[model samples]
Target: MGSDSHHQDGVGVPDELDRLWTPHRMAYISGANKPADGTPGECPFCRVPGLDDEEGLVVHRGEVSFVVLNLYPYSPGHLMVCPYRHVADYTELTEEELLEVARFTQRAMAVVRSVSGAHGFNIGMNQGAIAGAGIAAHLHQHVVPRWAGDQNFMPIIGRTKTLPQLMDETRRLLAKAWG
Candidate 1:
């Protein structure tokens, strides 16, 4: 799946997944591209509250901030804390909004730790699309749970990263933590 090859969907194959299967490579490559809408369209975190599932992947939701599991995560228990209002940069957030974001971020880390038995976490924001933000229109803080020996040869050698647990299980654990 080198860049020279054309994917079935007609996009250029990413070089990183040259030896990987189509479906797996596709998922990784897709993250590199921007969404067609050019905007988040609707805030996913904000919409979760009105949805049927109260104990959804969304462990917490506040007036101006919320936390949800990352669908495509670096780790199984990965989550993100995002502001309800759409903003591309942290500078756009008001004092109250920033406060909420920080509060949710801390809460998300606590939940991730409790659920995943993680020793530490990588928690930060990618400011723009160029800075590796998958959703450029909305600034969000990622909370990636980490273990002592979690880093392995997969990502470095095989260009693939494996998660130890399922999203559903992670969601269940975090939901309990929220409660």
Candidate 2:
């Protein structure tokens, strides 16, 4: 690479580093859609249950907890098991809520495996903002389906993830399989 190759265009400066721009992720990083206050009315988890399954991208609706597709998924079939109530911490869940969330998480894993033939899974919760919880206001457990080579050059080398499936499509497959 020559020095002239680093010229700044209207968009940005050309550099040696390869660029894969994902403007959509800015909303997540900037917390544009995050609730202003950590309240039920402003929380997406609390609001998702009221919407129809298709609109909400919900895979399974349990009595106390529900399974919904991750809008910005780590993988194609990434799902979150969440309680209907707007609780910030896992310890805040009632016995019924806790049991249902656990059940939903198990079912989510099975459904993802059956639908996508996932080789493995990465499942857990980021308890607070400091712990990397995108929506720290609501307690939810992530169930990310993983294949043999899912962690390829894109995420590792380029700091990007290539998601082959769309949200609605993944939701449909998982929801159908969950039934």
Candidate 3:
């Protein structure tokens, strides 16, 4: 009776069980759920010299703006375009800085699409933390590369997203484009 019951719905059960038991995934979940200390100070991303070669991230930097790979990315080529100035909102930025940001964002989108073969992109800014801004103190624009079948059952069903490439590799590609 038990064997028959197990065999009755065996197709997706194995895959589901395997995903649920992944040790690395478990660790990631634990780490994500841990409470943050919420310390406030200088913006880590603003410190440029220390950032180079840190991870598979940080593609390039310019006079007014810089590009960084999203550490917790929604897609493979996810990136953020941030101004050098530490401003909380877009309104706080100088017109020159805003113009630079727009130019850099367009350049970044082209680079990401050309390098990653992304069919489309989602680019925008969240005004505040309450509006889903991860770093509310620093104004930045997100440039997320998208593909036809980018959305999958993993994120919807398993609450996990799979990235196809490393951030370092993406950075290399973007750096070449920036040059």
The candidate that achieves the highest lDDT relative to the unseen native structure: 2
Q: Per-residue error at 51 for model 3, in Å?
A: 2.7
lDDT of 1 at 161: 53
For candidate 1, lDDT tens digit of each residue in 45-146?
445556654445676778887788776677778888888776779999999999998988888887777766789888898987789877777788999888
Q: lDDT of candidate 1?
A: 0.73
Q: In model 2, which range of ten residues has the least summed lDDT?
A: 8-17
The candidate with the higher lDDT, 1 or 3, is 1
lDDT of 2 by residue, 1-179 (tens): 56555563424463344455556667777887688878888898888899999999999898899999987777789899999888899999999999999889888889999999999999999999899988899999999988876666555666555677778989999999998
TM-score of each candidate? 0.73, 0.85, 0.73
Off by over 4 Å in 3: 1-40, 48-50, 53-56, 152-161
Q: Candidate 2: which stretches are off by over 4 Å?
A: 1-23, 152-160
Q: Give the local distance difference test score of model 3.
A: 0.72
